[model samples]
Target: MTSNLTDNTLDLDQAITSIKIWDQIRDAAQKSLRSEPVLEKMAHHIVLSSKDMAQGLGRLLSHQQPDTLVSREELEELFSFVAERAPQIITFAAADLEAVCERDPAATDFFVPFLYFKGFHAIQMHRFAYWLWQNGRQDMALFLQNRSSVLYGVDIHPAAKLGKRIVFDHATGIVIGETAVVEDDVSLFHGVTLGGTGKERKDRHPKVRQGAMVGAGSILLGNIEIGHHARVAAGSVVLKDVRAHATAAGSPAKEVRG
Candidate 1:
């Protein structure tokens, strides 16, 4: 009886066609984004990320998924997830940019990418790896992290906890150490190092609290908290806690302003 029924009317191809499956799926995704402001914003980020990944993959392989490979349905799903997490990512990205502006007046010109320019395949991968690390999938996170660094020349450790609105301007030679904590609204300039003091076992890296900006070529080492709204001057080596709204300069940074 079962074989007879299957032979009589089981048509998987036709069933998919009858539903207008792909078309309906695409339309539904678009509808959800259009209906919700939050979803729409998230969709923008997701689309950017997807495009970046597609471009990166194309560069790494001889055979590549066409730039147009991202279907509307897939893009919608990506945006939906981004919408749910937009508050966090947006906050971090902002903090990062604010930090850059504090360090250099001209920083805005370069840091603009994190705000509007999308094509940072490496940045998207870093975000994904960081998410994996938070979920306790360290191996996969590390694998992605290494891959991103090898391909893009940017090495941000997955274990680093970054707050919302973080910016990495002119993003070359930037190294974010493990155990480093970047709070909201932080911006890091090129050649910035949030590093440790010679492999010390205990929390041996800088903690950039909210609204902190580390200038270009700065080396902030050891376990120290850069207080809220603090600025680490260019080429400085910071080794101590900087009070909130203060500015630090020189090696073993000294408080310059408040």
Candidate 2:
């Protein structure tokens, strides 16, 4: 009986550790409230009073919807429905928060990204939009895209498939085309455009592979692949494929490192 109890306790601890993100957010929220009691009302609305990550995300994302289009309650209901139907959205959101906290120096904990970071919010909205796009609700997906752009200055097409643990640092003016694919653990900076060279209706956008990092204002065009672990220099115009573990720079980006 004693051994069984001990094993059960250990299992429970491991389970909690696996999803320690929500736990960390709650703890950070409490700490923030203590540090600045004046922010109690605002904090409670999104984080402190929320039951879990999903609920908190619903509050934060729904609040971004313009009042002229959708009411707060309606957007919250939609967000909750999407989260329920595809629970992995929440999983991806948690991974995203983890990435921001681990990669962004400004983000010391989950609470900051959960409540204030537009990049984080934009990514969550993109995930929700991706779900809508996958479900054949393209109209709704576009609506969410518009909301994200107007609110965060990030324009990510609904059809763009994004993997987990991705970070969009200072994501303002970032544009991703319909067929673009961003793989896991990738990081993108502000003003980056993953667009096509011409009016090709087919798969013309870039495919950014896992662990690659794109600098700010970089433009990667065409049906090219940004190889795994590749790095694009800031303000470069990439017209060709960047090989794996390589660094590309210059106006028309050329391989500078391998």
Which candidate number maximizes lDDT?
A: 2
Per-candidate TM equals 0.59, 0.91
lDDT of 2 at 37: 96
Q: Candidate 1 regions off by >4 Å?
A: 1-123
Model 2, residue 251: distance off in Å is 1.0
lDDT of 1 by residue, 1-258 (tens): 001110223345533442342233234445657776675654444332333322212222211112345444443344334324422332233333344445545544322332233223344455556756776779866866775566556788987776545666666778888888877667777788889989599688888988788899999888889998899998999888999999999997999999
Candidate whose TM-score is highest: 2
Residue 118, candidate 2: how far off, in angstroms? 0.9
Model 2 weakest lDDT span, ten residues long: 1-10
lDDT of 2 by residue, 69-166 (tens): 57989988888988777766677778788889889999988888888888889988988888888888999899999999999999999988788788
lDDT of 1 at 23: 33
Instruction: Name the lDDT value of residue 22 in candidate 1.
Output: 25
